[model samples]
Target: MQQDERQRKMKIMEVRMREIELSLSNVKLLLREKVAQLKEQLHKNGKADVLIGNLYDENDVLLEVLEKTKQRHIILEKKNFLLEEKISSLNKIMCDLTPPPSLPYHY
Candidate 1:
């Protein structure tokens, strides 16, 4: 009876060891899959970051151009105002120099 019991316990231990080995192999396979997914995600994120950086640079350049255009517009507006004033003054002088039409006398 003692020998039979020892033999049964040894058989159970061997089965358990096989099960543990299978579980370890499954875990290793899962870890390898997860590592591959993470690497792919990292590569995609790097490309997105570079594109965003380029857009930011372009936006900065556009802003600078807009500012310069706004300044030039302001300068032109000021010059136009001065020209209008001069034209108005010249018109007044021309009106003063012209003689008024005489009215017809009623009998």
Candidate 2:
């Protein structure tokens, strides 16, 4: 009985392995088909091939520019905030230094 049970378990494992291998093969085939389709499309439109090839580089450059712009924006915002605070402080000092208006005496 124990031997029979072991054989049954072995068969189940074998079947599972085969299913996994078949799934993998199917995925590989689909990927190959997709690549072939893309190649065909590229062949039909030769100009698109260059664009597709350079797209990654172009995207990288654009991303770098965006990052630099963001950094500059942050710096400008901080400077603006500091300037506002300084202006507020100067206004307070001016108000403090001013003398009060004298009242007119009765004629």
Candidate 3:
């Protein structure tokens, strides 16, 4: 009878061991799936980061171009003012060099 009881206990232990092994296998599979998902997410995030960086670089270049354009506009405005002054001076000189016509009247 003791031998029979021992045999029954051993059987129960074997069954429990099998259940634990199945549970461990399931946990391992879930872990592997989660790791794979995380890796994929990391890859996508890396690509997004690179894209954002490139956009920032492009924005910086555009800002530089805009600054240069503004400076050029200012320079042109100054040049235009100088040219206008020179043209006015030349017109005055030309008017002064011309002779006035004389009118004759009999009283």
Candidate 4:
């Protein structure tokens, strides 16, 4: 029973390893095909290839800037909330400190 169980586990592992290898081979083949296609396009449209590269770089830079802007916006929102709370507290204090006006003398 022990030997049989061990054999079964080994067989399962072997099958899993084969599946992983097949997947890796498929991925490599797809990468090769995509590279060939891109090379062919570059050869056919030289100016377009350069434009694509420039556009990709610009897109990367814009995405980075957008991320930074979003982070700054979050920080600013927090600061605004804190300032609003502080202003409200100060207003309450000022109201408490100020005295009401006395009535004028009667005729």
Candidate 5:
């Protein structure tokens, strides 16, 4: 009778071991899926970081070009003002040099 009881206990222990192993396998599968998802997210974030950096660099370049354009515009305005002043002076000189028309004096 004792031998039969021992055999029965052994069978119960084997069944419990199989259940534990199946549970462990399920846990491992879930962990693998979670890890894969995390890796994909990291990859996407890295790409976004690079794109944002490029855009920032482009913006900086555009700002520099705008500043240069503004400076050129200011310089051109100064030159235009000087040329206008010179033209006015030349016109006055031309008028002074020209003789007026001779007309008869009438009381």
Candidate 6:
């Protein structure tokens, strides 16, 4: 009877050990899946970071171009003003140099 009891206990212990091993395997699988998901998220975030950096660089370049264009516009305006002044002075000189018409001589 004691031998039978011992055998039964051994069988029960074996069954329990198998259940524990299955539980551990399931936990390991879940951990692996979670790690994969985290890695995917990290990769996507890295791409976004690079894209954001590129956009910032583009914005800085555009700002520099705009500043240069504004400077050129200002210089052109000053040149136009000087040219207009010169033209006005030339017109006055030309008017002063012209002679008036004279009356016809009497017989």
Q: Which candidate is the best by TM-score?
A: 1
Each model's lDDT? 0.98, 0.95, 0.98, 0.97, 0.97, 0.97
RMSD of each: 2.1, 14.8, 4.2, 19.7, 4.5, 4.9
Quality of model 5 by C-alpha lDDT: 0.97
Put down candidate 4 lDDT per residue, 34-94, tens digits, no spaces: 9999999878799888899999999999999999999999999999999999999999999
Query: Per-residue lDDT for 34-100 in model 1, tens only?
Result: 9999999999999999999999999999999999999999999999999999999999999999888
Candidate 1's displacement at residue 12, Å, is 2.4
TM-score of each: 0.81, 0.53, 0.63, 0.56, 0.61, 0.59
Ranking by TM-score: 1, 3, 5, 6, 4, 2
lDDT, candidate 2, at 76: 100
Q: Candidate 5 residues 1-107, lDDT tens each?
A: 99999999999999999999999999999999999999999999999999999999999999999999999999999999999999999999999998887798899
Cα lDDT tens digits for candidate 2, 1-107: 99999999999999999999999999999999999999998787887777877998899999999999999999999999999999999999998998877788899
Q: Give lDDT tens digits, candidate 6, residues 1-107.
A: 99999999999999999999999999999999999999999999999999999999999999999999999999999999999999999989988887766778899
**Model 6: residue 1 alpha-carbon error in angstroms:** 18
Considering TM-score, which of the candidate structures 1 and 3 is the better prediction for this target? 1
Q: Which stretches of candidate 4 lie over 4 Å from their true place?
A: 1-44
lDDT of 3 by residue, 1-107 (tens): 99999999999999999999999999999999999999999999999999999999999999999999999999999999999999999999988998776677778
Candidate closer to the true structure by TM-score (higher is better), 3 or 6:
3
**Model 5 poorest 10 in a row by lDDT:** 98-107
Q: Which stretches in model 6 have alpha-carbon errors above 4 Å?
A: 1-34, 100-107
Over 4 Å off, model 5: 1-30, 101-107
Candidate 3, clashing residue pairs? none
